[model samples]
Target: MRNRLNRRVAAAASAGIGMTLLLAACGADAIESGGDASGGSDGGVDTSAGIDCAPYEEFGEIDGTTVSLYTSILAPEDQPYIDAFAPFTECTGVTVNYEGSAEFEAQLLVRVQGGNPPDIALFPQPGLLQTIVRDTGSVVPAPDAVEAAVDEFYGPDWKQYGTVDDEFYAAPNSANVKSFVWYSPSAFEEAGYEVPETWDDMLALSDQIVADNPGGEVKPWCAGIGSGDATGWTATDWMEDVMLRTAGADVYDQWVNHEIPFNDPAVATALETVGGILKNEDYVNGGIGGVQSIASTTFQDGGLPVLDGSCFMHRQASFYAANWPEGTEVAEDGDVFAFYLPPIEESAGEPILGAGEFVGAFADRPEVQAFQLYMTSSDFINLRAQGGQFIPPHSELDTANLTNPIDTLSAELLTSEDTTFRFDASDLMPGAVGAGSFWTEMTAWIAEDKADAEVLDAIEASWPQ
Candidate 1:
């Protein structure tokens, strides 16, 4: 059934109608669902769409090749990427097999070291990519064509994210705007509240919410750092967001790379700033309870209180829209929406906190290289955008193609000429610190009510030597 769908979609693409059609018009072809994927003969190529194959043609014909891709994007989110690449398969008669999982980071390392790896893998953090590059040296660098496309389509900063040892080894695929706080617009209007324009204003608004509580029982902010084994990630995000605003990007980078100690006074200062909110018994865990409850509330349910008017704000990423109740409207005037977490007036520059995934290949086969290059190309980017919920790093993306207003705004912020964007700091740190101790220690500070200085000290002590 999927093969027939792909054939129909390929026909539509060849006829130049696929780019503007709905997602169902180009249902993603699942290579794994087909029988004996490796036994397929070359399907006919379709150039009727008038797609300029000039850029991809140099990789030579790879009519029967099958390329496997592994990623952390998972199920529904991964489908859009597969659909975006359908034209690649249609043009070259190559099958792109894709698998997504929550354990991509650990499993990818195991696969590479065990002498078996996918043709390509998408990395959510460059630090993990660096570890694999430095340790196994098994990953393939981006082809010249891919590098050139990245240079032409994305900002230099994004290119830097994918480079290791000064070699371009990966290409950014998807991105998320992280510095946002969700709130109920109608509730804000009913309570005569306005969006805070700066960090100080945000705090002042928090105080106002507390003051207006009928019995002084309602808090102003809600948060959750609980995410199972990855529990304290949300708290780490607060520190990173505050660090960019309080300590500036240079020092933030130093902290991530350990050029500055994790226990440095600047780091301490950021922790305290986070404490002003997360550690304040009056500021968090609205539906969940006091500050301690933040550690128990699942991250998925963290922001829900805002919808019930128990909390005024919930700091989270743009992708948190998925956590909202189905059929709930999410927009500036809808049930709930987000605003960029306002910048601090004292910061060195306006920095936006964000995260994204990078595409890297384990084999340099022509088919693998062709798919890699195509993944970041403008055509792939445009099609993915049309398929919905994709924010490509390509500087030239047409924001209008993004289906959601929030997503379009995120794209605007990321590509704005004056905005200096930084990837998630913890994600860029050594896993022992970024994914391990940092998560555990932050949870201790919130759950055990540990002192700020003590928590920082513990994390600094845990930094991998």
Candidate 2:
């Protein structure tokens, strides 16, 4: 279940043939910025109108030419954009050289370092935007119009992930809710279990499920930690959720922003709590060591049948619904239900895991701004929803238009909850710690008899001071 294919290819495939046409229209120069609008040594565009659509009178056309884009949208997901973008290309002669997600960062970094960066880069990870702001001078400030468009589509807080030091580097793109617990209605009903509304109730329910299963045939939960290059990230989600619930939002923010050490007592407690579930003889399938060995890809799928309706719950991001076995009851009926990971205690308040694409401006051209507006607009959400994609970042997406059950569930979670949503902690961490050290340490904590403090210490030590 590791994503073997390059994500860029998937992104391009999602964008479809419009990508081909866009790529074809590119001029001889790979980094063409069109005309002499560079405005010399000033290094900033005229943001008087901000990014207003009115100033876009000549938005579609750019001095008898079109702008080209290099992006990393996957195939299936990119299809809608491709379809939507065709009109943009036709309306404006601007072309886009859409690239696959594979090695896009490396490719773009090389280009930028070589003095030939793309006019725009659609980065899927938010941390990369911070890197661009700090390391590469390639990214420019957001035009007034782009910021207005972002506020219009996604709310003010939505821009937090893309903004740094009071300047915007990226715009919000598609989003997926991670603080969800998927359960089987039939299994829960057969067991006479009620959906737990509070954290205590949730644990009490898990305990009840375990007590009911005297024999070892049934497990109460399914927890998988496999994600290929990012295997340990799943564990980081659990830790973050628990931290948010047990320690509260202020502490959670500090941890995420690196103001508090990762090895702080609160973080350690979260790790221990998750480890307890893995270590408990009655909680997880295949036990601690077995869970570690279980491929992350198959972990979510394993919860489908639940060993004679014994297993009741699986916690994962919204993307997990797509991995359900095809033609299976869950898959056939779109059988999936999600509930917020209720706060650890009533006093903790509601907390959610929010992760998504962070779009940013590379150049200040009318076509560039227009394309960005189009990509993040409500129209784009509608198009993607029609194709059964997960939740769109724009909160205004009409639930009636969402055909898929998963999309419906995601939509409901967005509007119903009165919680603070935080992006995945690991995703926000530096690459070395996020993808490398964290995974190995978490797996060790589960598989071996490692001390919680030691694990936390190791993670804290790894953070880039």
Candidate 3:
């Protein structure tokens, strides 16, 4: 707790947000400084009064070693990760060089197959991680210390994400809640409507919104899957959310691995379920044009209509907070907020669909191993959380320190014992099917009014033969 307090003080100073006031906001009782505040050569960097380096001592002085990291998390979001591990360098003399790219998924495979993998790579999808492990046999397993930390800090479900051929190789680093419906609280209040708690209630509320606005001048939902080259990714998220609710996790898992065909009856049902909301002209592209307008509307602008009363709900992930107009307050009681999308009545359980990053290594050098251990530590995770926009999967995270209400809500959902969690399945399938066919076909279905079965069949046929 003392270390976390000191990190916040440091962060506040860095951000120019007045340390004293920030401390007061986060309820930090005191700040502790250690000897030689400028940091010492023996100790990598100046740390809080009592942060122990004994756990990392076994690696035995690899200060000159430079460990490279590659990831899809680009600056400035990636800088927090670099800052979180600065202490590791100060303590052990190992240099951590991180490189992030928008082209991470495509570039990562090329690098590995070309025999140029980084010392460590942060993968946004376990499916991609597994592919590298299977194809190149280059990924190093997490050292025993890191594995133990995984056991102590994270839930069992997280381990499965990093395991390949029964060997634990990576740990989930950050997470985001994907099953949220964003809306304006003031709009709901003025319309005399309550946040729905079930799939049935959600549809009924959508119906009521249309009936309340007879001329169809207003609509119940606004949506977009257009994201430049990543255009139809949002549609894929919708299918995964519905699949989790309607087909259950076990079936979802099978479908992800192609244990079941991509166009199975269950998948068809999930696609149609999404269509009920997205294809219904009365429920989609509000403030824009008809349902066809969604394909041209950028995903970043899809949810903005909620604030203007042109749309009632926008289904998006927690990180969509970044897209809300600059001055908007996204509090539970503020003008706009998000609610957990409800489950289908016949669903097996309340399954939460989300996404996160995993840390995988290509080298097993002692400094590399030591860095991996430190990166996944509870202390480092909490420090990253304080930087905001970073959500740790650690069950031990102090949610009170997480300043964003949306982040806190995501943490609460992730930590709940009863909530079943599943990674975004589209990201878990073979890239040919997951990224290529799935994304392309979904966009065609929405933009061109293609048949659901035809879209699903194209995706199924495109699965790597």
Best by lDDT: 3
How well is each residue in 1-465 modelled by candidate 1, as lDDT tens digits? Answer: 223322332232113221121100001111122221222222221222534466678888798889998876643355556666677777777888878654566678889999999999888777778878988999899999899988888777778878999999999887667877999989999999988767898999998988898564577998877665567878888899999999998988899889999999999989988899998877776767999999998676789999888898999887676567777898777899887787774554666788878889999999999888888776777677664556776766665557665565565555444566777887788767777788899999988999888888989998878
Question: Candidate 1 overall Cα lDDT vs. reference?
Answer: 0.74
Enumerate residue pairs that collide in model 3: 44-90, 44-91, 45-90, 63-93, 227-231
lDDT of 3 by residue, 1-465 (tens): 223322332233123221110000000001111121123322121234334577788988786878888876643355456666676777777777767655566778889899999899888777778878988899999999999998888777778888998999998787678888999988999999988877899999999999998888789999877665557878888999999999999999899879999889999999999999999988877888898888888777788889889899999887776567667887766878888887884554777788878889999999889888887776676667765555776766665446667766665555444567777887778766666788899999999999999998899899877
RMSD of each: 9.5, 11.4, 9.2
Ranked candidates, highest TM-score first? 1, 3, 2
Answer with 1 or 2, whichever has the higher lDDT: 1
Which segments of candidate 1 are over 4 A away from where they belong?
A: 1-57, 60-64, 214-218, 415-418
Ranking by lDDT: 3, 1, 2
* Model 3 stretches astray by more than 4 angstroms: 1-51, 93-95, 213-217, 415-418
Q: Taking the tens digit of each residue's C-alpha lDDT, what string does model 2 give over 1-465?
A: 012112221232123211000000000111212222222212111112222233455464474555555554443344444544444444444565554443454466667788877777776556656766778777888777778877776766668777877887677766567777777655676678876677777889888887887776666777766543444556767787788788888887888778888887788878877776665667776232245443343344445644246467777766555455554343212244545566676567666666776667678777787767666766555555555544566655655545555555444444433546566676567655665577678766765656788888887888776
TM-score of 2: 0.74
Clashing pairs in 1: 14-49
